[model samples]
Target: MKRIRSPQKTAEKLLLAVMTLFAAVASVIFLLPTVLTITNSFMAQSEINANYGVVFSSVSGGSKTFISEKVNLKFIPDIVSFSQYFSVLFKTPDYLLKFWNSVILTVPVVIFQTAVALFASYGFARLTGKLKEILFFFYIVLMLMPYQVTLVPNYLVADKLGLLNTRWAIILPGIFSPFAVFLLTKAMKRIPKTYFEAAMLDGASELQIFTNICFPMVRSAVFSVLMLVFIDYWNMVEQPLILLNDEQMHPLSIFLSKINTGDTGLAFAVAVIYMTPSLLMFLYGEEYLVEGITYSGGIKG
Candidate 1:
């Protein structure tokens, strides 16, 4: 039997369709420029300027004003080349070194930030005291604060501590993020208390309880934090510029800026190169993040 959908149900379905269409259109609009950049990177710079020729494109033979005459495209190159990519790596070896430097700097920051954040989250969920409340509140406030506000004080502190001009200058500070702790804590607190109580009654130590039960349960959250933090620092620029004055100590974020000054084409190529790690991580771990956010959000509410 065929039955017509009620007006309310029809309206709900229409709204969903409109929402989905909006999302897809928004995504395409955002992604279109990135796609163009990638495609244009494969093109030689001459081709990129071919459009300019289309406007001014005329063989000015002996100063005859001929807008009607079809001009041979002298500026238009016959071929697209990977010259930009080659220049980014070889002609300027700094691009390559900077690319690797970004990798070195970002990897450890993600690791330890995730490690400490997971434990902190567990603590927030499990522990009791006025101290925990105060500390967690402090973390949320700091995390929510602007990065620029913290930069000067952090630099001064690093200078005082003599950690300036070293990789540790950037890395050690990144290891102790408050946002990761806050988000994970929110996720972990959602886990049922009975699980922990049951584990304890069965003779598990606190350490054993965290490793066996808490970790597996909040796996989604930990993974999400790791991905987010990695991408955040991976694309950093301003921090290393302000804090680390030494040319060698400059992470790839600053290094990319230097290349940009030398060559625009090479700069875009570097952007394309530098984006791969974060892009791969995002694509791979999106499922984990979705599950983690849903789990974390619903765990308590």
Candidate 2:
């Protein structure tokens, strides 16, 4: 006997297929630039210049002109070369310095910001009062506000504190950022009150309960926040550019634009290197990130 699908079931299956196809296409579209950069980074500089020189070339008399020639967008290089990476890694000291500067500025922010958010989130999760709600609301407001809106104030405050022109200007604000607090607080709140009750009945002190119960339950959320905060600070441009007047103090992100204009070939290689940390972090923490985000208020048995 032939099995027949109901009209409603057939429609649902069709919709699912359509959505899946759309998602696949969207994913490829999103990944296209990353794929292009990685592949093109391996092309020899002469080949890169031959392919993209027209796009980057300036008109005479120091003026910009629209590209008259179509750019050759090659996915596979005729010849692969490591010269660009070699130059960025070994031949150039400035590139390495800026890369280290990015690391120096980003690592401390990720570590300390996660620490501060964990404690602050625990407070928000456990406390119950109009005051706590009001304060948490303020944090949401600050998080919602565009960083550009607060950049000027941050500048003024950093100037007053004599942190301008120093790495502290970038690190301090990032360490106390409210985004992680907002996320971790929500995650901690999702943990059942029964767990806390059990801990309290066991004579667990606040610190002990926080460390053993809350922290363990919210571990995935912590990883998610760390990955997020790392990505945010790793790609920071405006903060360092505005706060640090010393060109040498600027992170690689600040130098990326200049590199793009001057050495297009180097830009591709540097961009790949710049992307590596965030990419690796994401790949490693992807499962935790999804679990942390989608987890509901239920304790796993």
Candidate 3:
């Protein structure tokens, strides 16, 4: 007599194997575009323009090329040189400086917006008043509005305030986000009122309660808001394009568009470099961004 196996068990194992193979194929299909772009960037101009079937001689001023072997996409050339990175990083002078400008502009925006949103959120969360509800509603409306509608008003105010052609045109507006207020206020509300009352009983001022008590309680929410703010301002193209006329003040996002036509390679290189900081920041802070959504909003919210 032999041990018996159920047909159901066999079916389940077969299903799982098919699903796993499908997932692996899906992953490769999605990543193939990015992988190809990065790989192609390292290929020499000759290789880039090389006929799909024609294999060219590497020697300069050589005779007609022949395609004998399938060109391996994995390993591009004998040596992968940094010529593209070097030219984009060095040959482009003022355009490259736009990177630092973006950094400076974004750092201030993140700090100021996060701070303002935290306080505004505290008001909407804890303070008792009809005005608070009204103000909160207004912020929600403004936040939900499209960027195009808001751009004109923002430009006018920036102009009247003499913020045009300056970093402030972008930074100042970014500092006050309704989305941040909405997210953070919900986070703050989740904290039990008992803590606030307890702090008040101990003669703690609102500032003290906010700094010492409330701040610690909602640390994860802050990270979530910071992530959004960083991405929004870091990729800013329209605002800088409209607000700042000075080439020097334009952020990398705006500057990248300027040189896009002449050389596609440099644009790709700059874009790859420009997107690095936001990627690194989010990768490291992903846990907190994800944690805040769960702990503070919807379902458990």
Model 1 ranges off by over 4 Å: 1-5, 51-80, 258-261, 297-301
Candidate-wise lDDT, in order:
0.78, 0.91, 0.79
Better of 1 and 2 by lDDT: 2
Q: Tens digits of per-residue lDDT for model 1 on 121-162? A: 888999999999998889989999888989888899899999
- Could you tell me how far off, in angstroms, the CA of residue 197 lies in candidate 3 after the best superposition? 1.8
Q: Give the Å error, residue 164, model 3.
A: 1.9
- How high a TM-score does candidate 2 get? 0.96
Task: State each candidate's clash count.
Answer: 1, 0, 0
TM-score of 3: 0.79
Clashing pairs in 2: none
Ranking by TM-score: 2, 1, 3
Q: In model 2, which runs have C-alpha deviations exceeding 4 angstroms?
A: 60-63, 296-301
Candidate 3, residue 116: the lDDT equals: 92
lDDT of 1: 0.78
Q: Estimate each model's TM-score.
A: 0.84, 0.96, 0.79
